[model samples]
Target: DQQVKQNSPSLSVQEGRISILNCDYTNSMFDYFLWYKKYPAEGPTFLISISSIKDKNEDGRFTVFLNKSAKHLSLHIVPSQPGDSAVYFCAASNQGGKLIFGQGTELSVKP
Candidate 1:
């Protein structure tokens, strides 16, 4: 069974609009959550993250929200730009830093 899932396989949005990606997890042992953005050939790069202690974390145009009670999380990108188009992955880590990743969500930001 997949411990983490991104129900939506892809998202399309206009530039300067908002893009929201959703993810869910079944493991309660996860204490840390992270979002990563990947390009065609390059490796996934860290975007934003939130510890179980916080409900939200933000940086620039990216924000990550965690709802522990529901075992859900989401990544929000405001003013999405063409350069923002990428595959985004949601990941969760246990205390030992072992991570579980959801299926990636391909984001398309059209001009």
Candidate 2:
């Protein structure tokens, strides 16, 4: 059973625009969060992350916000670039240290 879900299968944004990707989880036990970016034929690479204790975390042009009460999270990419066009996955883990992943949301950054 899928504990995590990404409602949107894809998103398109112009270069220099902001891209927002959303995810929701049914498992309240999820405490650690992570976002991974993947290029075609490449393995997913860690992008950004947040813990349940933190409401938000930011790095460079990327930001992730967690809503523990809502069991929701979102990733924001500022100035979305064509290079950023790829599949993005949302992952969560609890104290047991097993990761649960949501279906990836494909992001297209048009030049």
Instruction: Report the lDDT tens digits of candidate 1 across residue range 1-111.
Output: 999999999999999999999999999989999999999999999999999999999999999999999999999999899999999999999888889999999999999
Score candidate 1 by lDDT.
0.96
Task: List candidate 2 stretches off by more than 4 Å.
Answer: none
Best by lDDT: 1
Off by over 4 Å in 1: none
Task: Provide the lDDT at 4 for model 2.
Answer: 96
lDDT of 2 at 109: 97
> For candidate 2, lDDT tens digit of each residue in 1-111?
889999999999999999999999999988899999999999999999999989999999999999998999999999899999999999999878788999999999999
Report per-prediction Cα RMSD to one decimal. Answer: 0.5, 0.7
Every model's TM-score: 0.98, 0.97
Clashing pairs in 1: none
